[model samples]
Target chain A: MITLPDTASPLYEKVKDYILANIGTGRWGKDRKLPSENELVASLGVSRMTVHRALRELTSAGFLIRLQGVGTFIAPPRPQSTLIEINNIAAEIVERGNRHRSEVLVLETIMPTKELALSFEFPKRVSIYHSVVVNFENDLPVQLEERFVNPSLIPDYDKQDFSKTATYDYLMQKTPVTEVEHIISAIPADAETARHLGIDVGACCLFLHRRTWTGAVVATISKLTYAGSRYSLGSRYSPSKSS
Target chain B: MITLPDTASPLYEKVKDYILANIGTGRWGKDRKLPSENELVASLGVSRMTVHRALRELTSAGFLIRLQGVGTFIAPPRPQSTLIEINNIAAEIVERGNRHRSEVLVLETIMPTKELALSFEFPKRVSIYHSVVVNFENDLPVQLEERFVNPSLIPDYDKQDFSKTATYDYLMQKTPVTEVEHIISAIPADAETARHLGIDVGACCLFLHRRTWTGAVVATISKLTYAGSRYSLGSRYSPSKSS
Candidate 1:
């Protein structure tokens, strides 16, 4: 049993809110069958049309699933990656109610190649901090992150233990990032990345090339790869009122 | 010789602007090598470090490619899909200075299945308009668009000539879309999609599922597939001042 919010919103919206509250409170778990339209209409004292609209909209919003000839069920939880935000992998996983862990594979200070120097806008042979970390969601490897940091921005980048604290988390605590750019592509994983992610060689992966700036100086550049089979990246858009 | 913009921007930004202007004005075509660091320093009256920073940032931005032991060269144009906007395929191609065309493969009325009825919130047995259009960029098939439309929203949906006016364009003119949601994923293409896109079967494809709403009614549901080898989607983000 649920109580609808008393407001000026339409009847369908109230029904939607009530249904969402039940889901949010964990009264209905993932893949649990939801009440049919007739049951909802009877419980909420609304018309069948109103209840149908509520369920349909929730399905469209990825919160519910409706199978033909079968009752509607709660959709399985999806790990949603925000398209417009430079999100830390650990934060994203934890936000989805999953435990996040990391394994540090490579961390060292190395001399930049000519191409790397050009990428960092630093002089040739300058030392930069490089690290490779594999992020896991409840023991399943999800992301392989390879990052290069300018030594000038974070002098002690190599001293931190990334398995305990994510690199992005550490950087955010030290300085304010002014801007971030992302280049996204789908690529076949090479042998190394495939091995780390536990996917077969040549499996497709979502590749994200990201660069962050701290007041016009490049602070970090990273190439992050996610297993395409288990992960998806998405965003939503609503036209402004003026438009 | 190109004249630089006289502004208060940093010297490196000004140099970057000059190089961009040359590329924009067709002075440096795709894959064309630009003047070396020493040559640019001598001509622009700027230090070597300034020129290095400008070129390095441009490469990071995907505007240039730097090769070791070789001069910098302009990168080939890439088709970038906006992550936040519900962009029309024709418009996206034309915006990239490329020719756009479409081949309509399937266009007819379909009886709504139970799943389709649930998706549209309509009763089963209702007829809906369905279409499949293959979008091309300079004759190369790039996307296979499969769509289902609520016939009540647009009465004459099947009569429109999609080659002359895109289905998305027509829908926009007929109704005011209130909200748009997107779900993005990566999957291997089916045999039919691969044959249509001229790619090998089992090749990875970028899959986009989009649904647009008119008020509370679902106006359209679309599944757009793009060749992963040729396309990538991206968006930019900047932290708000309040954040």
Candidate 2:
């Protein structure tokens, strides 16, 4: 039953390493209950106190969750998007060692309607650019993005290949974004959004409405819809007086 | 029908004032469709361009939703929380000129379990303060707050009248919070959370898990659940390289 043969590191660290190795190898799946304290002690040939410390440290690090009277279970992985700044969906997925791709549903120029004119604060007689893209992580759709761009700001917005370059990156490179506003809401998936995200029609979704300005004129306004189970927003900061 | 006798403001401004007066008097309810531009021009004896400008400005200000080919409709109100800072539920409601009250659900000290020990990084042999309170905005339940406090940080943790003093306010005043981490998720409410929020089981909820630190020790961990239809989070900031 005794498995611990390495003595260089501390017992708790070795225990932690062993558990992590198993987790890294997918031997311990998400939400899987760990062995009991006594059972771990017997199998690892470590003291109960050592096993407890290892488990405690792992739990504290958010590697596991101990549910009081219940047993310890694996915590689900949270892919996070910070609210303080604009987050590019493709960068986020690729940064996590996953493949990122986009399905460009609609990409063309449209005559401004009363809605577009009001949103862009421009004349409805002019033309503006509109696009709808569904971003995927490892072939699973996570975000359905609908964006309206001011043609004057990015003249060739519709000409670029969105599948090769993300609209956020393309826009950023095209023009400097001076101001950004983000509004987060939990809403039921609309029909088009649900179809693009491949979720049920009434499924809950984390909806983000972002408006970016280049100096005086609003450059772009985006509506990003994330399926509830796919992604989350996280932030860590110090409390400030103005905040 | 031509009652545009006001000479002080511009024609569009007068038109805006007239429509706003109706809205303020509850004549134009939320999401109510408005008369067509031609109808407004005919009735007010104003030029079509003047009525269009007023409606455009109103839609731009988020007072109305212009559905392109369809007629204009009123926009819904959104009560928002910012993610950049720790938000106190009571303060937000009151700032919006609404009454806020808390229904104290559970307030007691409990012996630390394996879960608490790992979360708080304290020994399981000690006790910790735990409380659950449901906050209401003008008597409608909106937020459910469940918190666990480190006894050392606030010695009189269990003795406070939570309905009178919010846990966030009390904890911050007791010991200065140096750091805070917020993780946001769109989740279906569990039975207990649904009961407290007065929503259907499996209804969508905006869940915020916050952990605060005082000095080197974690002072408190809280789970704040907001009914999806009741509240949303919003923030505006300049784009940063890191974000």
Report the Cα RMSD per candidate. Answer: 21.1, 25.1
lDDT (Cα, tens digit) per residue for candidate 2, span B1-243: 859756887888889878877765767675577888998999999899889878977775557788878998876542122233234667778878999999999999998678777878775468888999999999999999999899887899899998999776787667656567777778888999988899988888888888888767889998889999888876666543210
The lDDT of each candidate is 0.79, 0.79
- Candidate whose DockQ is highest: 2
Candidate 2 CAPRI category: acceptable
Each candidate's fnat, listed in order, reads 0.51, 0.62
Error of 2 at A203 (Å): 1.3
Q: Local error of candidate 2 at B136, Å?
A: 1.2
- TM-scores of the candidates are 0.61, 0.62
lDDT of 1 by residue, A190-209 (tens): 99999999998878888888
Best by lDDT: 1
**What is the TM-score of candidate 2?**
0.62
Per-residue lDDT of candidate 1, residues B120-219 (tens digit) = 8775568999999999999999999999998888889999899889887788767656566676677788899999999998788888887777778889
- Computed on C-alphas against the true complex, the DockQ of each candidate is 0.21, 0.23
